[model samples]
Target: MELTTPTGASILVNLADDFIHGFAKMKVKRIGYGAGQSDMDFPNVLKLYLGEASGRRFNHDEITLLETNIDTATGETMGYLFEQLFEEGALDVVLVPCIMKKNRPGHILKVMCNQADVEQLTALIMEETGTLGVRVMPHAHRLTLSRRIVEKKVVVGDREFKVRFKVAFDSAGVIAFERAEFEDLRRISKKTGLSLRKVREELKS
Candidate 1:
């Protein structure tokens, strides 16, 4: 299928053969069915359901957590590892400073990714960081919010620029939180010769 916007931009979508696909996230409360056209060999019907989801909206999925302690890797090397993990489809990466068993100062790197990407990411960690072993905790469930980015126009000084905002909604369809993207604010501040705080406050107003 193809879709075109007023500005002449286009989007193309291709579906798999012999399969139906849809994307939706909702809570199921009540269900009802309706019968259609009686002349067919198979029953034709439509199912309807209703529900209420309050608080935060989230989806359940399993993820893998990979961790390792590195006392020898340089700060630059660790930074590169972080970039590599993200490039390899890691959901999140975190580093925590710690003291090892031998009283050596070290840092613990934790990587979160989908179960399918575990093998590749784990191998990359070993190859890049040269860690003797990586501990993997599979079957970890996560609840993630549904999020989207919207372009907003903000004025700084005498000029206007488009800024991206992240909007989050709760399960009850209420806006849980909304904030301007930091990168946009930083860029605007540099261009307008304003402090980061001033730019942020101006955008908020």
Candidate 2:
């Protein structure tokens, strides 16, 4: 039987650091099971184990970092450039105000993307900003934690709104931190006439 799908295999290949021959020492913290729709003679469930490992706990991945200095682009042009970069699948983008050569005020545009996207994104940057050169650093190491998004309906005063929370988990399957989606919070605040800070506080309580 074909037990593993292509998507599942791809995820394991990219995310797994190493494959063990047998079980290693582990402090079991949490377990999850997924079942198929049809009932079989034997158990048809996939088991997932989350626990503490003796060595490294955090996940790591490689990414390409692209940076360019823009001294002539206007604020509006930079803003549109950022919007387009994100829409084109940039992992993250940052614009930092800085003093360039000759002490001229400018902004540093930094972009992070998958290694395969370096060529396309670099071209996009040059096309948008008219910059002659971009600094491309490949294979940049990044440490990361397991993360997931959960959605729930939250009631604030007389109104109920749906909100999604971005949750990050540590090595032991414990929640490291979580936060409500900013857009949902902003929507709730606008509808309820509550300040953004107050909306967050209310949601916490």
CA-only RMSD, every prediction: 12.8, 13.1
Clashing pairs in 1: none
| Cα lDDT of model 1 by residue, 157-204, tens digit | 789999999998754456778889989998998898999999987876
What is model 2's C-alpha RMSD? 13.1
- For each candidate in turn, the TM-score is 0.70, 0.69
For each candidate, the alpha-carbon lDDT, in order, equals 0.81, 0.88
Q: Write the per-residue lDDT of candidate 2 for residues 1-205, one digit (tens) a residue.
A: 7777899899999999889898867888999999877677889899999987664467778988999999878898999999999988899999999999998899999999998888888898888888899999867998888889999998887788899999988666778789898999999999999999999988988
Number of clashes in every candidate structure? 0, 0
Q: After superposition, how far is residue 14 of candidate 2 from its true place, in Å?
A: 21
Residue 145 in model 1: shift from native, Å? 1.5
Off by over 4 Å in 2: 1-56
lDDT of 2: 0.88
Q: lDDT score, residue 100, model 1?
A: 95
